[model samples]
Target: MPYDPPPELAGLSLAQIAEQVAARNLPPLDTWDPPETEHSGMRITADGRWFHRDSPITRPAMVRAFASLLRREDDGRYFLVTPHHKQAIDVEDAAFIAVDCKADGDALAFRLNTDELVLAGPHNPLRAQGDADTPAIYLSVRHGCEARLDRSTWLQLADIALADGGDLSVGSQGATFALRPA
Candidate 1:
């Protein structure tokens, strides 16, 4: 089946976005600590491309399925977890890419390359790093995973920040986020 992207963030209300986020039923990666471990030889590029043995994984469904099983350990390692086994995967940068973003009322919604919907809030905050010359923005996805905003999505969030104030900050879910270095 072909992957159908979600409707644009602009058209969705905060409640609607929350509904979509809640609708996703993921595996219990946190509880499933399988005794078996292996290296899957899968890697996620900085730009959100999934590769195995250096060849791109072209199927969207496969990518999405793998992404759902991804978990980041406290030691900064990523793994694709199943009930029976946990396989290591290399991540060039973030595990996912925020390909699209929009400001909805007091909330900010983002769509990942895997078509996952994330709402920026207290739980899933946005973090800005790097210096003025080279800036990078990331949104916390879940289970210690983050999504780096792509160029256009970063620009869209920047515009929203500037529209709100000169502080280069935006508020969502009763929390404020700075778009630039302090």
Candidate 2:
């Protein structure tokens, strides 16, 4: 059988857990984060891995790769969430994967995979709404910097890019998403 902490500890103070862990008095399975702030969430795994939703969580002293889903609100603030970690990474630095527009008609029939980079110039409502204006940045393999990535990676990347001011057009043929610069 596995050992589980009491339910009360699920939302306990992060400071308390940290202090115990630092002092080596606790088993290091507890996690915490400040409340009322974006990315202020925490979780504890069955294996005793303490996770902080505000930042990347990995095995102690280990580097882990993470990805997230992004959505742009009408107010302009970007909303992002990830299963690996609740922390949000700036979209500007993140990469995106887009489908080939030339092959696909204007019906917004495209896909975004992970590990591919997506870049755009500035905001143009006309382009975002799929009017006469075209998005500053579309999907292309060249934009990926010659790196080959699986479909999953591209999708993950697209999820984050779209959350950060990225827009998608639903056309007769397919769907297309764009990442415009701030």
Candidate 3:
């Protein structure tokens, strides 16, 4: 066995888990060396919806808990890892969605669908995929994971870009993203 959280911790509500995550005292996921397990047959859609066996997972807390355990390897595999298991999961586009954002001066902070925060720039550099006609934006989260920017969040970033000489080189904590015009 690896380093699993106490069984009691799994019984806590998502909010309680969030507090622990915020406090940064949860299980050390990166350090866990669990054996690889079979694919979980789960997929996270581009919009951040999760599906298991082609059925949507309706529980918000379940989704959040799974999201917390998500990890992406350099080989391009996504896994929902625990101390006891490293179950592969499919990601159609991205593992997370950035739905909202705030710009405090030049620093930018994005709120992901997973209820996690991603600060734009430097270590979390924002980037774009696709092309000018249909740009797919993404923000790198820690641990080699990323969150795709949802439409509304993209628009917010675009607005900031327009205000700043048609570019998004301004973000929270002095982070900068460059968004070229379509």
Candidate 4:
């Protein structure tokens, strides 16, 4: 079935519709899903070495950048990174750290270190896991760049970051910019 506009949006202008979409301020849809993930902690090596660990590891020199990182793409997705943690854990050698994300309302946490990617979900006790292979870092850009995020633009960013020996992180922190294509 075709989607019909809600009564509240019936008389809105194209610009208004666009604005609401950009701000994520539109009325909740019948199928909205609540955000189900959060970050608990992260660790990076002091000497900038990446390793994998199975327990809580510490690195003191890795500092959280104060300003948020924003990466605007030509398509319509924004990549943003901000300092959301209270304390920045230090990473040295192969060590592990924890990260918490919301899942089904409860906190789903995991421990990620040099090589391991642990995903904890509220629904299951057995941790869903993976490997980082390489450390994922966050970067941000200016709000003005929001006009450039799109599929092609994001692909370009991914290409550039990968070419520079970096891979895009999978979660919202790794890519938190909003889409505001022109």
Best by TM-score: 1
Model 2: lDDT to the true structure = 0.30
Sliding window of 10 residues with minimal summed lDDT for model 3: 1-10
In candidate 3, list every pair of residues with a backbone clash. Answer: 106-171, 107-171, 107-172, 107-173, 108-171, 108-172
The lDDT values for all models are: 0.91, 0.30, 0.75, 0.28
Off by over 4 Å in 2: 1-36, 39-68, 82-88, 93-95, 102-108, 115-135, 138-182
**Per-residue C-alpha lDDT of model 4 across residues 108-160, encoded as one tens digit per residue:** 12212221122222221221122343222222112322111223333443454
Candidate 1 lDDT: 0.91
Clash counts for the predictions, in order: 0, 19, 6, 38
Query: Candidate 1, clashing residue pairs?
Result: none
Residue lDDT tens for model 2, 67-161:
22333233433333333333432333213334321111222222223312222212211122223343233333221211122344335444544
Q: TM-score per candidate, in order?
A: 0.95, 0.26, 0.81, 0.16
lDDT of 3: 0.75
lDDT of 4: 0.28
Q: List ranges where model 3 is wrong by over 4 Å.
A: 1-26
Model 3 RMSD in Å is 7.4
Give the alpha carbon lDDT tens digit for every residue of 105-151 in model 1.
Answer: 88999999998999899999999999987789999999899999999
Tell me the TM-score of model 4.
Answer: 0.16
Which candidate would rank higher by lDDT, 3 or 4? 3
State which candidate, 1 or 2, has the greater lDDT. 1
Better of 2 and 3 by TM-score: 3
